[model samples]
Target: MAQAHHMRIGEVAERTGLSLRTIRYYGEVDLVVPSARSRGGYRLYTETDVDRLQLIKRMKPLGFSLDETRELLAAVDGLSADDTDEDERAALAERLDSFEAAIADRCVTLRRQLEMAEEFAERLRRRRAGRAASA
Candidate 1:
């Protein structure tokens, strides 16, 4: 198998459609810290960081607060076999389930909001049409 070269921060940002500032801010907050730094002092990210940043993007769209995002990322980071005890695996699974449910709830709320907006627009259109017909 061919080895993959490490990606610079800008490359990661371009690939993921995230701004460089956002990537740096995520690093500053210990969210998705870069894997390493280049000799020139630029941040270098690995494929793993790319994956994590994508998850963060998805979570934000699903209405996760930063705190929730942190917890979710922590849960994800704790998945190593070295980080687990025999008894803790189940607990970790439960925590992940909770995060998934929270995201699903946010999706439902967004759907409802979109439906409400569509209905409101329809009503306004009908009202405008009625007024124009009267004139």
Candidate 2:
């Protein structure tokens, strides 16, 4: 059975490792939308909706565009249980491949950034040590 979406936006924010501002912005951008609203219009989220947010969180680091995110989700959603066709499966596979490649590329870029940051930190440490020796 599909569980009821019981949690408010703040709870969802905490559970999903996202800021409230980021969650609201995701809603505004038509990413992971809230499942319900309170009588006072406060947003509520289902477990599934929170799961969606988690997926979005994972995607964010990979630098996927909102439209690409939507498209990838749509491609997976298109694979309804009884609607399986080879052509559709092939299309979905192709889209997934593209997303995988993009994520891998971002990982390499991030590693390079980390290396640069580490080098900068080492330089600062060396400079501090040199000044201390001179003093």
Candidate 3:
């Protein structure tokens, strides 16, 4: 694939399916910042930035906080091809497992919240019927 290309912020947004505002927000949060800027002050993104954006997009739906996302990106940054050490690869794998666990916990929390909302609605319906019968 062609890795010798750059894109402006607009094109990055289009390719990533993220809004311009969201891309800017990610930059502000230090989740996915532009690699460089054009002479005209436009944000320039490289292939690495595209990959980071993809990671961020995937993590967001899993309810990852910006801080957690930042840490994950830092972990990604720490990987090196020169480091053929087993310990280093094992450490990275452990961190990824932790991230996955966090996402799973968030999914459980969301399911609980949904269940609570449903129960609350049913209680509200019961109260409404009780009031209607007395009226």
Candidate 4:
């Protein structure tokens, strides 16, 4: 069997654009536990671990709570497992679909909020310009 290459926490943090503290916290919460530990007791991660952290990072911006993120991760893991039975796979797929729908709804809400914020900023800019013109 081929051994997977491992990275220390700093390297994983660099790759995932997450702070060391955040990574450690995630590990504590079992969101993205390290694949191994070094002789010196440093957290060591594999590429798969990094990928998990990246997924969590993406989900964070979508406003998923930690528990929700963990649930989604569990569903993803179940779906990916080769030993998952067809019945389990169907349930996991259904969970994934629900998450997808929630994400899409959140994204639409975010877009609407962003548009309103931009419009407000534009209105302010126009008001400033009008004041300057009169000055």
Superposition TM-score, candidate 2 onto the true structure: 0.83
Which 10 residues in a row give candidate 3 its minimum summed lDDT?
A: 75-84
Best by TM-score: 4
- Writing each residue's lDDT as its tens digit, candidate 2 over 1-135 gives 965858998899889889999999989988878888889999988997888888888887878889988887767666644586889888887888888898889999999999999999999999999999999
Ranking by TM-score: 4, 1, 2, 3
lDDT for predicted candidate 2 compared with the true structure: 0.86
TM-scores of the models, in the order given: 0.87, 0.83, 0.68, 0.98
lDDT of 3 by residue, 31-134 (tens): 88788887999989998888889899988887778888998887777665565477877787689889878888988998999999999999999999999999
Candidate 2 wrongly placed segments (more than 4 Å) = 80-84
lDDT per residue for candidate 1 within 31-113, as digits (tens), equals 98888877998888889889999999988888788898998877777766686875677777789999878878888999999
Which 10 residues in a row give candidate 4 its minimum summed lDDT? Answer: 30-39
**How does model 3 fare in lDDT?**
0.86
Tens-digit lDDT string for candidate 4 (66-119): 999999999999999999999999999999999999999999999999999999
Worst 10 residues of 2 by lDDT: 73-82
Q: Is candidate 1 or candidate 2 better by TM-score?
A: 1
Positional deviation of residue 38's Cα in model 1 after best superposition, in angstroms: 0.8
